[model samples]
Target: MASPPCSAASNFDCGLEIKTRSVEQTLIPLVSQITTLINHKDRLKKTEKTLRAIQKVGQAVGVAVGRFVAVGEAIALENEELREEMGHACFEARRSGTAIAQLTDVCGVEQSAGVDRCTVFSDKMAMVKAARMLLSSVTKVLVLADRIVIKQITSSRSRVLVTLEQLERVSTFQEFVQIFSQFGNEMVEFAHLTGDRQNDLKDEKKRARMAAARAVLEKCTMMLLTASKTCLRHPDCESARINKDGVFQRMRLALEQVIEIVTDARPGAEPKALPISIYNGIQDFKARVEALRDCVYCVPCESLAVQLEALVEQTEDFTDSAYTSHEQRENVLQLCHATRQDTHNLVATFSQDQQSIKAREVSEAMELAILKTSHSVSELRRELHNVAVGRASELLKIHSDHAILQALKTAGEDGNLEKVADLARTLTEQREQLVETCRLLCHISGTEPLEITCIHAEETFHVIGPQIISAAQTFALHPNSKIARENLDVFCESWESQLGDMAVLLKEINDVFEGRRGDKRAYLSLPRPGKHSANLKTVKATKLDAEELSTIAKLGLELRLVTSDVDSELERWEDQNHDLARQCGSMARVVCSMALFTRGEGVLKTTLDLFHQAELLSEQGLQLCSLLQDFSTQLLDEERVLMVSEMEKLAVSCQQLQACAKTPVQGKSATFQKVDSCIQHTKGIMTVVASLLPLWHKLIRQCQSEHSSQASPQHWPDTQLSPPLKEDTLNGKGSNGFGVKSLEQHMASLTFLESK
Candidate 1:
C-alpha cells in the first residue's frame, strides 16, 4: 500500500524522525569546527578568555578531554577489579567440586554425599556462582553496548549522496523515508549501547567504531562547507549558528596550515655564502685587532718611538693576522665552494659550451683575478733580524779589536806608534760599552745566543783594522810620504768594499719596509688563473647584470666595513648615536602600544609600520627574531584542537548512554557504571580545554594592539622598542586556585582511560 498521500499526521512522524537523525549526524562535527574557529577568530580570543576567566574564577581551566580520559581510566580500573572478583568466585566454586577428594585425603576423613548435596550448601554455592556469572555477563554486555553507542555517536551525521535529479528519481517519498529511518535507527541504537560496553568492545565493534568515526568526520566536513556557504549568503544566522555549533575548529586548523607555509621561507632568497660560524669568528678577530690598534694609538714618543720602531714594524706585519679571522677565511672558502659547486652542477647537468670557451678555462682566469695581500715576506724579514741579532754583541767586541789593529797599522805606516796606544785604549773602552749594549738587546726576539764566527769576524776585523792603521800612519808620517801611504790606501779600499756589502744588505731590508722592492702585482693579483671565471666574457658569456653587480658591490662593501680600521673617536661617536637611536625606537614602540590601547587599532597599525622601517634600518636580526617569537606566541595555540576533541567526546558519551538504555540488559549495574565513567571523562576533557582560553585571549589582544599602533614612514623615528617585560605574577600559584589537595582529590575521583 502506497501509504496515504502524505497525510499531515503521518508526514510529521516521518519527517520529524528523519530530520532528527540527520541533524544529530550533522550537528556534532559542525559544532566542533565552529569551536575551533572561535578559538582563532583572532589570536587573543583564547588568551583573553583565559585571563578574564582566571581573574574572575581564580582557577585553572583545563581541557575537557583530559578529564574524560581520567574518568575513563577510573572506570577501566574498577571493571578490571570486578572481573578479578568474578574470576575468584568461579575458581572457588570449581575447586569445591573437583578438589573434594584431595581435601578428604589431606584431612583423613570420609566424604559424605549429604554435605555436598544438602540444600543449604548447594544453594549457597549456586548463589555465589550465579552472582559471579551475572557480573561477568553484565560487564561484557555493558562494554559491547558502550562500543555500539560510541560508533553511533561517531557516525550520527547524514551524508546525502543523492543529487537533485537522483532525489527526484525516487519512486516515492515512502522508499526515501524507509531508508532514512533504517540508517537513523542503526545510528541511534549504536549510540545508546556503546556507552554500556566501552571497555570490553570486540574487534568487530572496534572496526565499526573506527568506520563510524571516519564517516562522522567526513559528514562534519561537508556540513562545515555548507554552513560556510550559507554564512556567506546570509551571514547573520549562519554565523551565529556556526559559532554555536563549533565550526571554528576546522577554520583554525586551516589557518595553521597557511601559517606553516608562510613561515617556511623560499629556498633562493636565503642569504649568500656567509656561514654563521664565520661571522662569529670575524667578530673575535675584530676584537683582537681593535685591542692591538688601541695599544699602538695610546703610545706617545719620538726618540723612544724610534728605538721601538722595530717592534712597530713587527706589529704592522702581524696586522694581517686579523685577515685570518675565521669569518673572512670561511667566507672566502664558502664563496669558492659555492662557485665550484654551481659550476660542477651546471657542467654535470648540461652540455658544456662547445662553440664557447670551456668552464675550466674561465674558472682558471677567475682564480687569477682574486687578490691576496699577504705579509709573509715581511714576516720573513723580521725572522731574519731575530736570526742575526744575537751575534751583534760578539761582532761589536771583534770590531773594537779591529779598530785597535787598524789604528796600530796606521801609526806604524805614519811612524807614529804612540797614537796607536792611545787609539787602542779608547777602542777597548768603546768596545766594552758596545758589547754590554749588544748583550742587552741580543735576545730581544727570543732567538738563541749568536756566537761570532771566526771567518766573519776576521774578515771584518782585518778590513777595518788595516784602514784605521793606515789613517793613523798617514797622520803621523810626512805629507809627502807616498810609499808609506800605499799600504794605507789598499787597507782603506778593502774596508770600503766590506762596508759597501754590509750597507747593501741593510738597504735592501730598509727599502722593503718602505715599499720599494717587492712586486705589487704579486700582492694584488690572484694566485689561480680562473678564480673569477664567472666574470669572464670570453670563457663564459654573461653580461654584468644589475643583480650580479649589486651582489658583488655589497660583498665588497661588507668586507671593507669589517676589515678597515675604524679607530677614530668619530666612529665611536657614530656607534653611540646609533645605539641611542635604537633605544628611542624601543621607547616609541611603548608609546605606540599605549596609543593602540587607548586611541584605536589604526594607530597601532601605523606604529607597526614605522617600527618595521626602523627595524630594517637598525639591522638587528636578533631583535627581529625576538619579535617573531612574540608574534608566534600570539598566533599559534593548540587549545582549539583540544576543544574540538572534547566536544566530540562529550557528544559520544551522551549518545552511548542513551544507546545503553535501550539495550536488553538495560538494568545492569555495569552498564550504568560505563555511562558514569564516560560522563566523567567528558567532563574532565571539558575542564582541560577551557583552561587555555584566557591565555589565547591575552595573546590576541597583544597582536591586535600591535597592529593598530603602526606608524607613518615619514614621521617614523629612527628607533625601535625593546621587548616588553614579562609578568612573573601572571601564572603564579595564586593565579590558579587549584591547590595540591584539591587537585589530588579531583584526580582520585575520576576514571581515566590509559591510551594504548
Candidate 2:
C-alpha cells in the first residue's frame, strides 16, 4: 500500500496512465543507451583515434611500402648504374671538356668558342665508349644487390639505403631514363633477395679495392706531374704531344699502379700507410739534382773574377818598370860623380887662377922684351949722333980740314981739281950713308958689330971709317971676356935660385892670401887641410875586408868597392846644388849683413843685426820655404825629378873638372888643402850655379811675401807697391792687405827666379 502511494506523481500518473508506458520503455532504451554510449564512446573515441591512426598508417604503410620497395630497387639498380654513369659522366664530361679544349688549342690560349674543342672531344669519346658498354652490365647487378641491401638495413631498411643514396645524388638525365626503365622490374627483385651476398671479400673489402687502385694511381701521379707542367707550360702544345704521350703513358701506368699499391698495402697490419706516390717521385728527382749543382758552381766564380783582374793589371805594369830603371841608374850615377867632383874643383881652382895669368903673361912677355932692347939702344945712340954730329964733321976734318987747308992754301996754289972733285963727291956721299947706318946699329942691337967697314971708297979711302971705329971700339970695350967671366958666375948662381923660387911662390901666394885673410896662421902652412870642408867625413883608418882580401889580394879592396861606387855616384851630384848652396849661403849672409850696415858706426847695430839676420833669413827663408817648397813642389811634381837633379848637377860638375885636369894634386897626401883647395876651388862647380841664381831669386821673393799675405778670394787690388816695401803695412791699417795680385804674383815669381 506504501508503494502504491510512493508514486506520488507516478501514482498520480500511473495513476496518470501507468506513467506513460513506463516513460516509453525506459526512456527509449535509456536514450538509446545514452546515445549509444555517446555514439559508442564517440565511436570508441574515433576507433581509438582511428585505431591509433590505422596503427600509425600500418606502421607508415610498412615504412612507406618498405621504403618504396627498397627505393624501387635502389632506384632500379641506381638507374641502371645511373644510366651507365650518366652516359659516362656525359662522356667524361664531354671527354674532359674536349681535352681541355685541345689543351687551349695547343696552348696558344684563347679557344673554346665555336665549341669545336676537338669536336667536343670526338663527341666525348663516343660517349665514353657507350659508358664503358653499360659499365659491365651495371657492375654485375650492383654486386648482388649491394650486398644483400647493406645487410638487411635494420632501422626499417635504413630508409631504403638512405633513399638509394638520395637517388644517386639528384637523379637526372631523364631521371636516369625513367630509372633505367625500371631495370627489368627492379633488378630481378634485387637479384632474388641478394643471394650469395656478392661473394664476400673484406679485408675492408680488399682495402676498398686497393683504395680504388690507389686512387687511380694517385690520379695518374697527379696527371703525371701535371704533364710535366704541361710540357713546361706548353711549348705550342699538340696537347703537348698528347700531354707527353697520354700524360706520360698515364704516368708510367700510374707509377706502376703506385708501385703495385704500395706493395699491396704493405702487409696491412692496418696502423696506417698510403702516401707513396712512387716514393714521392723519388724525392722529386733529388731536388732536381741539387739545382744542377748550383748551376755548376756559378761558372767558376765568374771566371775567377776575370783572371784576378788581369793579374792586378800585370802587377801594376811590372812595378812601374822596376821603379823607372832604378831611378835612372841612380840618377845617372849621381850626375856623373858630382859633375866630376865639381869639375875637379872648378878645374883646380881654374888652374890655380891660371897661374897668375901665366905670370902676368910672362911679365908681359918680359916687359916687351925689355922694351925691345931699349929701342935698339936708342937707335944706336941716334946713329952715333949722326956719325959724331954730321958725318964725324966730315970725318973730323982736322978742324974743318984746317979751315979747308988754309983756304986751299989761299985758293991760289989751286984747290980746283974740278973743285976738289966736287968736295970729294959730297964726302963720299956722306960716308956711304954712315956705313949703312952702322950696319943697322949692329943689326938692330943683337950687337954683332965687331967690324966697322968702309971698303975702298976712293973718295972715302982716306976715311978708313975712323980706323974702323977705332977697331970696333976696341972690340966693343971687350964685353966677351968669356962672357964677362960667365956673367959674374951666372948672376951669382941665378940670384939664389931665383930668390928661392920667389920665396916658394910667395909662400904659396901667402898661403892663399893668408887663407883669404882669416889667417888661422894661414891654415898652418896649408899644403892641404880640411879640404874646403863640405863636411861629411868618416875615417876609421884602414880597412880591407873584401872577404879578407885574396881576389888578387883584393885588388885594393876591389878598387875601394869600385871607387865606392864612384864616390857614391859623386856624392849624388854634390847634393844637387845643396839646397841651392844653402840658399846662397843665406843670401851671402844677407849680403854680408847688408855690407855690415855699410860699415863703421855699425849703422843701427848692423841694421839690427842685419834685420835679425834678415829675420833669421826670413825664418830660414821660411824654412827654406818648406825646403824650397819641397824643391819647387818637387819641380812641379817630378818634372822628371827636377830634370834628374838638374842633369845630375851638370854631370858631376863635368866629371870633377875632367878629373881635376887629368889628375894631378895627389901631392903625397898630407890631407887637407881644403880637399886640394876644394879640389882646387871647384866650389862644387860654380857653387851650384852661383847658389841657384841668388837662391832662386830669394825664393821668389819669399814666395812673393807669402802670396801677398794670403787672403784669398782671388785677391786683387794692386795700386802699385813693391818697390821695397812700399809703405809696408800688411797686417795693419784696416787689416787685410797685400793684394795687388799677390804682390804681382810675387814680383812675377821674383822675376822668374831672377831670370833663372
Q: Output the number of the lDDT-best candidate.
A: 1
Candidate 1 lDDT tens digits, 477-570: 4334332343233334334333322333333334443557554221121123333323312221112212222212222222111111111111
Q: lDDT, candidate 2, residue 9?
A: 25
Model 1 lDDT-worst window of ten = 561-570
Off by over 4 Å in 2: 1-583, 586-626, 629-631, 634-644, 647-677, 698-706, 709-756
lDDT of each: 0.31, 0.29
- In candidate 1, how many Å is residue 311 off? 99
Evaluate candidate 1 by giving its C-alpha RMSD to the native, one decimal: 43.8
